[model samples]
Target: MNPTAAILIIGDEILSGRTRDSNMHFLAQELARVGIDLCEARIVPDRMQAIVRAVRELSAAHDHLFTSGGIGPTHDDITADAVAEALGRPLSVREDARAILQAHYDRSGIPLNEARLRMARIPEGAELIENPVSAAPGFSVGNVHVMAGVPRIFEAMVASLLPRLTGGTPLLSQSLRILRGEGEIAGPLAALAADYPDLSFGSYPFQQDGAYGAHVVIRGADGARVGEAMTRLAALFPEDRAG
Candidate 1:
């Protein structure tokens, strides 16, 4: 079976609308490309209890958990500690991580003070995730992979991490644009979905040039099944444009 994953976004800025989240969608798409199902996503404030609760719940329910935000050197960055607490592990500064940060800061002529050192505090038994964009690294504790919230850094970390994960068959998809309303196609789409229980069918309504239409998309792990479903859908709506 394909690995199941969940995302936990930790930040008060996201919750208060001060910052818009762009990491979840990126992670979801990347995970899907590697055949891991992104089953759930959640955002929580920078509270220890809330982060701990979310981490514990998602960690237990999914094969992998990817988290963004709250791993920085700032005061509100408590993801590492919360994860440690949730897993019943002690949070401490590892010399190896501290050395990496120290060398990076020394080369850049920045001070590696107490606040900067806080970035090296990892949970027991967690593995450090390489950060190419910045020297500060993310870590994977158990199944929870903690990452940065910055879009560029998150993307970079994912590029480094995904190749190491085990993936099943990649999902295949096809879309057909029909010049008909979703209401007109809903019944037939439902029937088609029931016929191919392994594939997923979705109808997305769109408006173009003051005309309403729908895009019927078929997605499945089996390319042949997806193509067959797409063909059946197109035959059902003969006038539609298949793309």
Candidate 2:
């Protein structure tokens, strides 16, 4: 089986539609690049109980769990606290995180207030994920990785941790856009998918300028098989190209 991952997004802002949750899609794409199959995603509010429950559940369900949001200096940022609660431990300021954050504050010449210091609090026995843009660190507890809520910081944290994660063979994808409707090629695509059961095939329909187009995407770990599938797909629709 492929190595699977799940993402948990914790924030009242996202739940209330105040902010669009972009972190899940970013993690999904990055995990795909690293050969980790992103199988599930959940977005919960900033409530402590909900955050704790989602973290615990996702951690147990997937090989890797990624969480974004609620780890900032604001009052609503309670991800660190919730993570500790989930693990049945008290949240404490981690020494390494504190040191890094202190240096950041010192360089900026801004006094590190208690609210900012809250960023140093991490779950017990967790490895820190470095944030290159901001020294506020993310952390890993067991299979769950806790990260920042801001899209920029969360993406940087993910990039930092990518090298440390061992992944399976990376997935390869091939796509062609056929000047036809999805209904016209759905049967053929399904048959091709069945022929190469190891691969996944998807057909997406789009309408533009009174014309119909279907984009067929074939993806799998085996490069040769993916190429072969693309060949068969092209044979099914000779006019299809990389539109």
Best by TM-score: 1
Per-residue lDDT of model 1, residues 1-243, tens digit only: 899999999989999999999999999899988999999999999999999999999999999999999888999999999999999989999999999999999999999999999999999998999998887899988899999999999999999888888987778899889988888999999999999999888889998988789888899999988998888888998976634
Q: Each model's TM-score, in the order given? A: 0.97, 0.95
Worst 10 residues of 2 by lDDT: 234-243
Task: Compute the lDDT for candidate 2.
Answer: 0.89
lDDT of 2 by residue, 1-243 (tens): 668999999878887888888988888889888899998999998899998899889888899999998888989999889888887877898788899999999999999899999999987889999999999999988888999888999999999988998898889998899988888888888888989989989888898899888888899999999999898889878865545
Residue 33 in model 1: shift from native, Å? 0.9
Roughly what TM-score does model 1 have, to 2 decimal places?
0.97
